[model samples]
Target chain A: MSIFETIRFALRGLVANKLRSGLTVLGILIGVGAVILLVAVGNGSAKVIEESIESLGTNTLTISSGGFGRQSSTSTSSTSLTVELATALADQSAAPHVKTVSPVVTSSSLAATYEDTDVTVGSFIGTHPDYATASNFSIKSGAMFTTDDVNDHSKVVVLGSTVAEGLFGTVDPLGQQINVSGKLFTVIGVLAEKGSSGLSDPNDLAIAPLSAVQESLTGYGSLSQILVQAVSADDIDTAQAEVTSILNEKLGVTSTSSSTPYRIMNQAELLETRTSNAKTFTTLLGAVAAISLLVGGIGITNIMMVTVTERTREIGIRKALGAPKRTVLNQFLVEATVLSVIGGLLGVAGAVIGSQFTIMGTKPVIVPSSVLLALGVSVGIGLFFGSYPASRAASLRPIEALRYE
Target chain B: MSAHRANRPVLDVRNAKKIYGSGEATVVALAGVSLTVHRGEYVAIMGSSGSGKSTLMNILGCLDIPTTGRYLLDGVDVSKLNDRQLALVRNRRIGFVFQSFNLIPRTTALANVELPMAYAGVRSAERKRRAHAALDLVGLADRADHEPNQLSGGQQQRVAVARALVTAPALVLADEPTGNLDTQSTADVLAVLDSLNQSGRTIVLITHEDDVAMHAKRVIRLVDGKIVSDQRNGHLAASRSAMLRDAYSTAVYR
Candidate 1:
């Protein structure tokens, strides 16, 4: 038979029983929908992690002193880091991978006024201007501080982009001086905006020089930690080992780590671990949804069986009129495929509606592969599920079927 | 003894046997039946229940393969033909109308008639034209769109008859085709069958009622799987009940 003819007959048979076909395809829709959606979420998270890791200087290695534990994110509390160590690292002859080593010390004293808005925030850092380059900061309006400003130990600070907007408003705050506990720091340049990373909001603080902060902001005896960067991103592992070895030899500390208590986390390794976990979770969720697809196939089979029983006499009539078993099987099989294919299309429709728009506007995300895969699988399901029923219809004894009342 | 027999009969059966099961559980459906039917002959096979007349009709219809026999249809031995071949033979040479009007429910009269043509691979346009013609022959062209549920008993039987004759097969094997019909409907359906028979089409009708058997030119009656009465219906009886059907429809329509 021609394709059109097969489709026509199959469509007629499907239309004859609506509820049965509808319920059957519902399973497949849920299965395919779940799989596509979960994979999308997994892909989305992968993108986020990749970007975050790349933002942490893909071509640079960072070394910190004092905050070694995994829980000690950037909170520099230990007194082990000092400006002397930062100077020695910067002066190292063998540290060819070293780009710049800037000691970091933070002090939190609130209450800053610009115009009329006075917000008492926390977490302020004091470091060299090269910290901007190492941390991937992008300036919206002004430049970062010059090295001369760092050398002079001038009481100069730059505001994070968010702080610049939040405090300075439209007025140029570059030339203005902000008072911190009777000490005034000149605003040299406005640091650019760096949006939130996994750890911290880059635009939520003010940055100042380490020497200036020690003299004027914190008044602590020594710096809290040193932020060291390597020149090339690929050499991070080697650079990391060198930094740790130098810290141990310089700090006069004995080797006391079971698994390197001074934890050195490369962003790449963390990203890899996260990606694998996401894949596993996505597949697990997708498998749960696949059960619904299986349910749909079974539904089709059951309904087709019922149809065979109901049309027993018709089968007999056709057989007596010269229809072969193969022809009969083909007819029923065609009908089954038609029902499944329509249901699969409905599933695609359902996924689009269910995922992106109805399921909080995350649309069913038409990955061309999913559409083709779902349709292919459903067609296969129809053949497998419809076989027994179609065969049963074909195998009906003509004599008995004709005798059926 | 017959003109067609001088050549070759359209149907020739010799020592045909059909047993229900094997070994000690076997029940013979047909026991060594032999018969010959020429073309253009109206034959009626009649019997009480379990007399093997029904079995004979099934065999004649090519609905079952005999366990043992030499059954020839149109000079070709049918006992050796495959199931697929038998089905083709049935469609090309034999049309069938059942007692219960085995028209597919929820289908219109036109579609019911066109169904067999579809299985025969007749294209759409020709199928529609021929199906309409069959419906017109049964005087149900106006009711083509109506489903079996909407049609009266006689109309439904007429639709079945239209289906049977739509392909213009060589023979029509109606197994008690009018058994469930009212007298009027039976007359209408039987008259259509009779006219078609008179047009040189072979027809084999199975019936227990003598009133129906009298409509045919020949009768073969079986009792206990054996032929007990084989006679020409030339002087046996007339179909009084079927005649009453024609009278009732004439009164109703005219």
Candidate 2:
């Protein structure tokens, strides 16, 4: 028989059993839809992480006073990263690649009150004004506390967007005073809103001059960490090397010792690590979705087998009319393929529509390749799963089939 | 009819034998039975249950291969043909009408008739035109769009007859074509077959009914896988020739 006639026959056969055929299609639809949607969610989360990391200036490096494993234990007492070390690293003659160095001391949780409202700040940080530039924090109103304010030990603080909203609500607090652990400080600026990255909320902290915070809340202790910005993205490596050498000389540590009391984390390296981690997560999601697709393929096999058995007499009639075995096989195979292809197309539409809304706090980004792969696999599933039943129908002896009840 | 017999036998079988099972459980369905049928002939093979008439019918219809035999249809040695080639032979050279009508369910009467032609790779337009013509010949032209289930038993049988004749094969094998029909429906189906035979289409009707067998010009009775009698009804042949002469004279006068 002609291919056109065979396809028509197959379609008519499916139409004759509408409920069964529709259920089979629905199985495949769920499989394909899950694959595309879940993978898109994985991709979306990865994009969110990458953007957040990029927001923390790609040329910036965080210098903290701890090393990994054994190195951290032995070197903890030998040399502590202090404000003096931060100052020396900032010298123009010694470190040309280093653009700005901000020494930061953090008080983890401190209750701050404005009038009757009191809220516990997630992070109360003491740092130079340069911390604002390095961390990409922009002032919404009023200006950042200047270097002169740090030298004078001014009792001034900048509220992050979340902190400001909690303490003052709609009321403007540009010049209002807020109490931090019983110490009153004027709010000179409010940081612009930054949405929470997966790790922590960046807009739930307050910033102040290092000298004022150390004198009041923390006393003269080792600086919490150092924030260093390289002059440009390409200068990050050279700047890190310069800072290492300066710290090594001042702290009396030899380069050959293999242990240091400090560690510098490169923002670019962190981004690469996070992106790869996200890719692994996406792959895991894809694998899970693929299992459902396999089950859907199995569903096709089950339905096709039933159809072949039910139509044995019809097959015999066709054979008696002189239809070759190949024609019979093609008819059943085409029927199965049509079912899956329709389901796959609907799945693509479903995934595309489902991705439009945010899912689990992340807007899903559809991967083009996942859509194509799901469709291709569904078609392949139809052909692969369809073969067994079709061949069974084809191999049936005409006399026996005709004799069948 | 004599001129057609002189040209070539439409079907020729030499000692066709069919066996079932092996050794201890062996049973012979067709035992060294030989038969020949010519163009423009209507032959009926009659037998009770287990008389091997069905076996011989199957072999003659190309639906089964004999254990040992040389069978030719339209001068083609079908005994040596493979499954694929046998299917082609069945499509081009033989038409079958089963007892149950065997029309594909859910298909229109027209498409049922067009089936054999479709397997022969005929184009859609030509298939449709020929299918409609065949249905018209069976007096089912108005019911061409009806499915098999929608047609009555007699109409369904007539549709099967239309499907059988649409291919214009060397032989039309009808296996108990009226077995499922009422008396009136049987008459209607048999009348369609008579008209087809009158138009010079070869027919082989397999039935146990003596009345049905009497409709054919030649009757072969099988007993226990062996043919006991092969005779021609002289009276029927003589009357059919008279009818043909009247048709010829009318054509000449017109």
**Segments in model 1 whose C-alpha atoms lie over 4 Å from true places:** A66-122, A140-143, A160-203, A217-264, A357-368, A403-405, B1-6, B22-26, B234-254
Model 1 earns a TM-score of: 0.81
lDDT of 2 by residue, A329-390 (tens): 99999999999999898988999999998998889999999999999999999999999999
Which pairs clash in the backbone of model 2?
Answer: none
**Model 1 residue pairs with clashes:** A59-A233, A139-A192, A321-B91, A322-B87, A356-A361, A356-A362, A356-A363, A356-A364
C-alpha lDDT (0 to 100) for residue A156 of candidate 2: 99
List where candidate 2 sits over 4 angstroms from the true fold.
Answer: A69-78, A87-99, A231-255, A272-280, A357-361, B1-6, B234-254
DockQ of each model vs. true complex: 0.49, 0.71
Across A1-405, the per-residue lDDT of candidate 1 in tens digits comes to: 455665676677667777876766676666556556655554555556566667766655444444345224534333356777677777657566778877778776456666566545355678888777776765555566667777788888778776777777888988888776557877777866653556666577777877777787687566655666777777767776777777666665467642232334565566668667756855675676567677878887888898888788877877776677887888789888877887787777766665554333222334567667777878898899999999998988788887776
